[model samples]
Target: MAAGLLLLVCAGAVLYSAQAQDPYDGLPDDYKKGVDLAMEKLTLDPGVRHHFRFLKTLDKSDIESGFGVKYIYHHFYLKPTRCAKGSTVSNAQTCPFRNDRPLIDCAVCYKTAADQIESFPKPYVHCIQKPRLTEDTRTTRTEHCKKMNYNSGAPTLLAVSMPKN
Candidate 1:
């Protein structure tokens, strides 16, 4: 009877340990769904969005990728829009839009992932808008954001991308 009880205890302990060990357990399902939705939206603009995949367990990989993409998008697409009205707006900076400000900033939209992906760093996706310059006038540019990386991690682990549009 003692031996059977010991075996049962050992099995319970092993089960507990297995349940406690979470490789991608840090990421929540809701957050993962949000990321999926955002990625789907971005994929619609595949010509202008780049997706970079990375390992899920690493920290800051997704954030870094998101920031990098935000940097490129702001510089090429959003900045130009701000400058169109002869505003002396600085590039590669935070949002200039206030509650009363009429300007729409991409940083406001793209920065969401930076904070959300603090735990899992897998499937880090970023979009770079490649704008074509026309006649030295910078008008009539074709903006294309391409996926830089895709599914770049081990098959055993789940990689969650950032959810920001």
Candidate 2:
């Protein structure tokens, strides 16, 4: 058995298989299996898509299996929706946030790092991220400001009355 293993190793073929997923393409079979199992167990949301990359291993080779150990970063990107005017602040003159151009693509997807994950990362917002100096849309957080009562009493049909015996 040892002689056969030696022959296999001499062929320069690591523990990778042809049928492994694209993210685990170069990873060893055992590591791919583990990652696959782990990913299957993830509580992924409905719009989440499978996105993974092979990371470096703590050990270059598994001590038990003599195969290359692999690390992976796997997470799904949240699909961004079109910007809408949701802010209800009364003092704001113009709408906050980038309502001009929507995010065409995820910036993280084009980055060079293979093992980086962009799970639930906030997209570049114009008002928050690249706000103009003159735009007064950003809310100034105030600790001492009087709370504006939004609940100005809901509309009612009948007046309040005392309980009758």
Candidate 3:
């Protein structure tokens, strides 16, 4: 019975790890509201009324707290559309809207010390109309939000890309 108890104790202690955590676990309610705002108004074109399809918010393990503010990254995928008139396309293939799928990221910085949570004015995360080359250099839109620096401690999202077709 003593040996069984010792084994059980060791097993219990080994299984009692508590580091498990969700990146968005302690996120402020306003963050969701901000995402909603982005969803409602985020568009591919200001003049064309082309709205973006909200994919997901970029996740980070370092999002628990900050002194003054927290930046919430909201990512949305925008399909390629015709380039607006007067825009210079040096290679024609490099025409931003013609070949590459634009991944627009809205990074909203929320004031953490605010007295009013919901009433706080929405963050002005500008639309990223530019696209970068994909990591694999492939044209398919496989660039969903994921953590970087796998072995290293600091995880980050690589910039959205415009890979070669």
Q: Please give the distance, in angstroms, between residue 2's alpha carbon in candidate 1 and its true position after superposition.
A: 1.1
The residue ranges of model 1 lying beyond 4 angstroms of the native Cα positions read 1-22, 28-55, 61-110, 113-165
The positional error of residue 42 in candidate 3, measured at the CA in angstroms, is 2.8
What is the C-alpha lDDT profile of model 1 across 1-165, one tens digit per residue? 999999999999999988555322354443343334333445466343233211132122122333322211111112222122222224312223223222111211122343342222233333233233234322211122123223324332333454446
TM-score of each: 0.22, 0.21, 0.32
Q: What lDDT does candidate 1 reach at residue 16?
A: 97
lDDT of 3 at 66: 32
State the lDDT at 129 in candidate 1. Answer: 30
Instruction: Return the candidate ranking by TM-score, descending.
Output: 3, 1, 2
Q: What TM-score does prediction 1 earn?
A: 0.22
What lDDT tens digits, residue by residue, belong to model 2 across residues 69-165? 1122222211122222222223211223233432211111111113332122221111111223222332321111112211222232123443557
Cα lDDT, all candidates: 0.31, 0.28, 0.40
Which pairs clash in the backbone of model 2? none
**RMSD of each predicted structure:** 20.9, 22.2, 19.8
